[model samples]
Target: MKAEKWVFGFIFVFFLVVTPIYWFMSGEIAGTFVLGFSALLGGMIATYLGLTARSFDPRPEDRDAEVVEAAGPVGFFAPQSMWPFWCAITVALIFLGPALHQAWITLVGVGFGIWALSGWVLQFYRGDYKH
Candidate 1:
């Protein structure tokens, strides 16, 4: 985590220094904004990591331990389900409606999005049993 934090910190500083230099050289607004925002995001992450460092235990990677030393309790992942696909379709509809100037499509997409969200949240829920 320390190393990761430093890497992001470096990114923040590097982009911070480069953004103005880039703007002065190219005089382009879009690239300047991108670089500047990149710096902001990097700084945010580095700050977050730095602030939380005290609560975080040193991981195997930080100690340069073997990979097997870190192999434990990865995390929970949802089982297979079609809700994700349905959710993607709803997002497409949401964007497509505005793009095509059809308010009805966007409304439908929003409605379906609510349904998809509920279904996805409750997919693992089985009454009177472990989910």
Candidate 2:
């Protein structure tokens, strides 16, 4: 977490320096917006870090703590998943369909994507009770 703090500090400082350089070079209203946005983001990050600094848990003193092992596998393991393949195909079509002016193909892709996602979700609930 010390590393994270340094990283955030560096980013905040870098943005502070870059904002003015960008504003001077671009001379555009968008540069001002970017500067303001970056400042706001940096402030928020700093605030979060300040508030959460004490919440980080330190490592345990005993390095050889006994860990309890589970009796068996915890959850369902579905063997087959064609849904992912279908979802990937759907995404590809959604990306390329608009360029080809195939609106219907895009709609079909969206439908297929939804269907695949739903099937994947339902698979979690289909396990037998092992106990």
Candidate 3:
């Protein structure tokens, strides 16, 4: 986390310094905007990691150690389900909106995607998986 924070912080500073120069030299607004926005987001991420890492002791990786226990599973993961496939289908339909010349299909896909996402999120609320 410390390393991440420092790397992102460095990138943020580099972008901040180069954005104006890029805009002035190339007269291209898109690249300037992208660099500036990336810097802002990177800075935010660095700040979040910096603050969060302050609460914990350094890890084996931070100390450059080769400890096997440190590579253990962090937590259990949920079993896979079919909602992601449906979501992918919906996204594909939405992505093809312009090519298909049909916005209605995209809108319907968005609705279906939202419904599928909700079902996926609440899957454990009932039935055999209830908790």
Clashes of each: 0, 0, 0
- Please report the candidate that would top TM-score against the real structure: 1
Quick one: how many clashes does candidate 2 have?
A: 0
In angstroms, what RMSD does candidate 2 have relative to the true structure?
5.8
Between prediction 1 and prediction 3, the one with superior lDDT is: 1
lDDT by residue (83-128, candidate 1, tens digit) is 9999999999999999999999999999999999888888778643
Compose the digit string of candidate 2's lDDT tens values, residues 32-72. Answer: 77876787687667767756766865323223333443234
lDDT comparing candidate 3 with the true structure: 0.86
Residue 86 displacement in candidate 1 (angstroms): 0.7
lDDT of 1 at 130: 39
Q: Which number leads on lDDT?
A: 1
RMSD of each: 2.5, 5.8, 3.2
Error of 1 at 129 (Å): 9.3
User: What 10-residue stretch in candidate 3 is worst by lDDT?
Assistant: 75-84
Stretches of model 3 off by over 4 angstroms after superposition = 64-66, 69-71, 94-111, 125-131
